[model samples]
Target: MTSRNPWSRPVGRRSVLVGTALGATALLAGSQLRFAGRSRAEGADPWAGWQPPVQSFPNTFIEQNVPIPMDDGVTIRADVWYPADESGAKVPGRYPVVVTTHCYGKALLGAMADYSRYGYVVVVADSRGTGASEGSFGLLDDREGADAYAIVEWAGTQPFSTGKVGVDGFSYLGATAAKTAATRPPHLAAANFGGAPTDPYRTFITQGGNWSSSSALWFALELLGVAPLPFTLNSYGGLDVQPRNPTTDIATFLTRLQTDGSSIPYRFAELQRLIDGSNNFDNGFWQERTTDVGNIDVPTLVYSGWADLFLRDTPRDFRALPLERGSKLMAIGPWTHYSLPKHIGSRNDQPIDDLLISWFDRWLKGIDNGVDRLDPVLLWENGSERWAGHDDWPVAGTSYDRLHLTGTRSGTSNSLNDGTLTALPAATAGSDTEVIDPLAGVCSRQTVQYLGGLPVYLPIAFFMPEFPISEFPGIDQIAPCFRTDDRANEQGALTWTTAPTGTDLLFTGPVALTLHGSTTAADPVWVARLSDVAPDGTARPIGEGALVASRRALDPARTKYSPDGDVVEPFHIHTHEAVLPVPRDAVETYNVEIWPTSWRVTAGHRLRLTIDGAEFPHLLPNASTPDRLGTLTVHYGPDRQSFLNLPVHQGAFP
Candidate 1:
């Protein structure tokens, strides 16, 4: 539900006069001088009397529905907001323009007004097939990019425009801005992208071919909220447990429900069809939507949240952009999908707004605002509530240290050092194994309030509270982990270790796994989790990575790995999906790549790595079956050295 504004009613002329008087006093006191400036050519500030701060401006909010004609002759409906005084007295030749593309919910009048108050001619348009726009909304498609370009060009020619265009928004809007930048529209000068998904297959919808359960649920809710009339929960079954009435439109609601799994039969039909249609990582679909970061020559500011679902994608975009432009800046904070203006950490509410103003000042007004001289990247590190600027991301001067595992066992004599990564090894033959019951779904740590009775599900909610999965009390009832004091127990889980570091270490980038063992089945799935063990014997989950074995082939163009026979390699596996087989009792090593993360394991914190068969919530439970990875007989040794390889950055910022 949206927040209510008690002061939303129109103010009388007397009230407006009083408000203007107060604003004038503040301007005279030099509080809003930064925003009051004279036109370069005229040498006289047109807005000198309008010295009201952005927050207190007497905005004449007007929402006009206009049919924006695209190149294809398709007209998209846009809700345009401009100062009501535009047609009144003579104003500056033209005003700077900012365009916003709506998310899955389409454009709203209230949201559009919020941007118009910022002193720009704001245009909010419904993507094709959404809201009042023509054509079918096929999620993210080429048509939307084309439409954005058309809108920018149209805005540039309008009488009220200064011919400078800037685009801003999050998620889909962010992606649109990225795509528009790549297109290199003549009028598009700058952009602000937040929580944008760089690679659809790698970051959005599915990661490593595994569909995000939370994302799926969110899309389902969107469908329910937007569908037109007669909202029915009958087909959704238990979904009705939560009631939501967002819109009276039946078509919008039905469209949303059509995206859910419960209506799969009538919506998607064959499971393989849905998967094949969305398996666009290597296909032409994603290729068309993918942005050419190297081609985005315009100034850009990218924002992301540490806790955001699209955190990974935002960083990827920042790293991929061309450095020569020197125009790219990144701002990340501790926040989730919905929380903006306020964050869990850092104090930079004005960073987004200030960045926009400075960007426009330099690009549109040709004023030197020192924006180009700002640091290339700014990130918010957790535990520290301040912003840190760097010449590049993944901070320079990082090094990698391998932690080797060593222990004795109770299970099979697979005691060949098992070469797995770990601070120590198991000591027994019978280690720990947990059978996860899918019926009792795991609870997540992340939650969000919405129009529906239910709360939004987040990935953070499923993190294990303690180390040694066996120690988790909640798992005992649904899934149990095998336990043994024996450090050599190599039956259920694989253990790896690194030598204790005499000095502190900082590492960033992707983590990898190289396994040298065979399983009884042709297809197998394994999971690897990296953690830090404190001297106090407490363990905390730092970073975790997993991959479905069927998709093990590495994309040579994007893969990075160490040359040492250690074999922990990084590969972008989106190019292909291959089936790998293991002969029974045969030692065949498999190199696995995990997700990326940044961390500094202090001198006293032992870098502990855990190799397990499953990770609940984050990943689906690995049910051992003849059809799956087959009966597994795992082994590890230095000759077949299986370890975690980390990318260490080093060097000073320019």
Candidate 2:
């Protein structure tokens, strides 16, 4: 199932390749083990500060442009950060290695360096082709995963290393880390990463077979060794660059720029072919790209947030890991991609950095630090702002509750028709209509999420009205008013609202939306959003889902069903054989899988379901017919009622 060329050797012809060839065993053959301790540490922890968590080494040193050779003689390069003495010289002794791969040309993802001072060797590599490494850039390709496996093993077996390795990164790098972990490399001790989706096809490139323009564009530009200016915003504090890692210096950068000009066009062509062909399906090329964390055979710490773009997969990834593989942990906090480490309320009590440090220390250092005894799932409840520990994801006490749509008005938002959402079906059949809008979801938090949190701190909040600005150097730029507030984004949508609940209702997991409706066009796009409407009628989006009607065929085996046999999570078979045609006049059943969320709708707050035609820059319809944009008709009644399925719980998650 692993794709390998077994013959493409670009290292021989690469004009800009840096670093020298060294075998795994010979990498540190001449190096000798050296031990040095702090003047104040005969029996005490010297680097300890007023900080709650004590430190290890006083400083760190970088060994730039270290070569990570693959079996076929191709060379991958990395920058190694070694624990240092007070004077800042590499303390050469056996330590565990943590390898993180990046597609950025330079030291873009530098947060990995911070772990070096914690007594572990941290190695950051530029993934093949994107940086100075030699090969055609394979974005999330199996070959790249192959490269990650090589990097880990190479860093592991070195003389200065203890032959134990862990992988780290977020988003793109996180995907590569997951792949590396899946390979089950012998030296792979653990994996600590975040913001990764199991299937890149679902959120990164396409959603329910709907094309996501912004993320796709961002990655395309990155393959060319360039990035959108917006992506350069705060990176969870990953800005510490270590001098000139061959690929980062002025001379090598100019040369790689030239290489990108000649190579990226072909890369773009390759990506387009996949989009135009069978890769659009869930099982072919996408199957290879999907991260099967189940294949992982070691301890892992998968970090995520309810507000992340890939929220649906974070908990899913945790649930998939085999219990036979010792201990693993998943932390779901109130975070966006840029607000990655910004723990909110109960989460702050258990700092994210502290959790990561304790995890790696326990696994890599062979320390019995008792982190394994921590709850398998650490979650932050939104409205209540309380931390809850659970035995597993989806929580033990969760029960799927269905709420049907009706034509009666709730008088909530000023959407096309403020239809009613209820626990029971309507007595009589009715339909509400709304004209299709091609440009939607731009003025919402989704804009920031899909952009990888691009404008999180940018001062242009007024220009976009979607990004939060409160994080930007203590600037009160009206960002607090827009973070999840979705009134502007849903103005053109057709909505169904639930009357005020008698008590609090907690939605703690994946969500599904069923639409028994029809569109005026031959092919249509369905965008569904679940929002919490306060007593003041202010609606804030909680979760969202989208589907291209043509790819709506479901795979029964993989779909999740409730105890009552209702579909809780619809798994669609997106192959060409499964594609269905949309007739303008006939009503069809369409199910949209909303990304997971953890939020509470209070007693006075109502729940609103909004249906639109597009998510704009975030997603575009992938229709065969060019003129598929049309009006939508949502039907509600005992026979043809559409409804929203929620993962509801009454009290503590248990």
Candidate 3:
């Protein structure tokens, strides 16, 4: 049931934060003024990269398998880490608490060793229905948010708590933290999120309004980890059944699994089924799961990468946070979802430990760390490979530049057509068409991102290379590689390229594309990409998007627009009733949302827009049989012109 978008789970299922002090120690010892490459206007140094010496505890101790009762009477599992004296004995002083909940199980988290190793008490809890927690797995259900609220309040009442609590994590765990923050728990003083997006229906579950089973395989993996069958017991160490009742007991664990694993939602199994069929539409169920950032009252920090899967909304959510100015912070790097803040694209030197430590110290401990005076946003200009401070996302002085598709050539890219992309509308009428290759995009960076950079780190290419299809020539090049050129994957793609520019084009926000075209097939699947083609013809990916022709009904209220009333980010209704059928061979206009992104294309680089009728691994185009595999045509002319809107920061160039 999963989309063939490479091989792996969604979000940062692998990157987890544990209670560790060693990491915190590194932060404390790290040089604060190290990011000399950070972009700043003359005399503009708002970022308090200056890390003050954080007072630390001699040691830390964990209370394993702590039973935490939720509001619904079901008890969840947690591991409470407390600051200890030099002798490794627990201390008596009360400290601010950091609470985090995860469906990936508490025991699997790595030693995030930065917070607890300091003076704060950290409580890591397991989401209900996963790990040792009682209740069926809610996969972004409201029940999980309620459970977080209960856990936060409980942590605030502990003997070592200062009555101030902060929620934190990366990916799914971060989403839980955001959900907890939205509940506005009495003890939640601040929150931090990394690659954890609040809007799921349009961005995660059904990307670009094209239904996605992206989580099906991941959910099944979770199901297999904690299933009742003795042979299906977790071998990944992501779950611990004995921890629910005892500290250790293999036989008892198997016995408990056999008796208690028959849940109403069947934990992972039932959740996946619901997502695949009944819960596919955006309705009351998804609305409850989507976190409204406006409801989050505490100070928050948003962290994400340009290539991150959830980049679509993390910045938008930050811009929506109720807190004003520097009360909330955001950092958008040039890395992927697979990378952590500490280990990023290396454009920005500050690690998550450093950022979070200072953040926690400022709000949780009342330190005058100058965090509230720092620029609200910190971005790493991708092409420049440098950090740039900003007032906010969409980068303030950004302008929407429209690039129209034309029949002429730019002679820049080695694309299938090498067609031209200019600012002015085309004078002549022309249309470009290509046969629908449903299995395209197997060798691009999107494949690496979907698989969480697996091929880059492991030998996935050696074992699971791209399958060769007789119908699609050169399909055998699907072998995964790290950050390779896109020209190979651009085969059969209809491209629109611009002449090399005289000045840098700094794009800092969501891109919108208006398409006036039709497909011979009734249900057309469209995939588009924006790339920066270097002088040597290396097409590096900037961002990518996809959509099924039938799901194009827009929701005006949720759709974002510019001052001139142009759609910058279009939100579709995606509900059961909003679905409209496309007539075969009939022309139709559609808004193709190019997912939000931030990057700088050098002066000599040419911008290219590549379109394909099919995408593999990231999206399964044939989600429905008889959906038509006919030719996809893009029309261009004065009346039937299609254009791509880019957010350009005019002030970025010298």
- My TM-score estimates for the predictions, one after another, are 0.68, 0.83, 0.84
In Å, residue 302's CA in model 3 sits off its true spot by 0.9
Cα lDDT tens digits, model 2, 150-175, are 88888888998999899987777788
Task: Return the clash pairs for model 3, or none.
Answer: 4-617, 5-617, 5-618, 6-617, 20-113, 21-113, 24-114
Query: Candidate 1: misplaced stretches above 4 Å?
Result: 1-60, 83-93, 108-114, 221-281, 341-362, 365-370, 383-386, 405-504, 520-522, 562-569, 575-591, 620-634, 648-654
lDDT by residue (422-454, candidate 3, tens digit) is 877788899888888777887676775654444
Prediction-by-prediction clash tally: 61, 0, 7
User: TM-score for model 3?
Assistant: 0.84
Q: What is the clash count of model 1?
A: 61
RMSD of each: 17.3, 14.6, 11.9
Error of 2 at 244 (Å): 1.7
Off by over 4 Å in 3: 1-49, 52-55, 110-113, 212-214, 220-278, 340-347, 457-482, 625-628, 651-654
Give the TM-score comparing model 1 with the true structure, all chains together: 0.68
The Cα local distance difference test for each model comes to 0.49, 0.68, 0.68
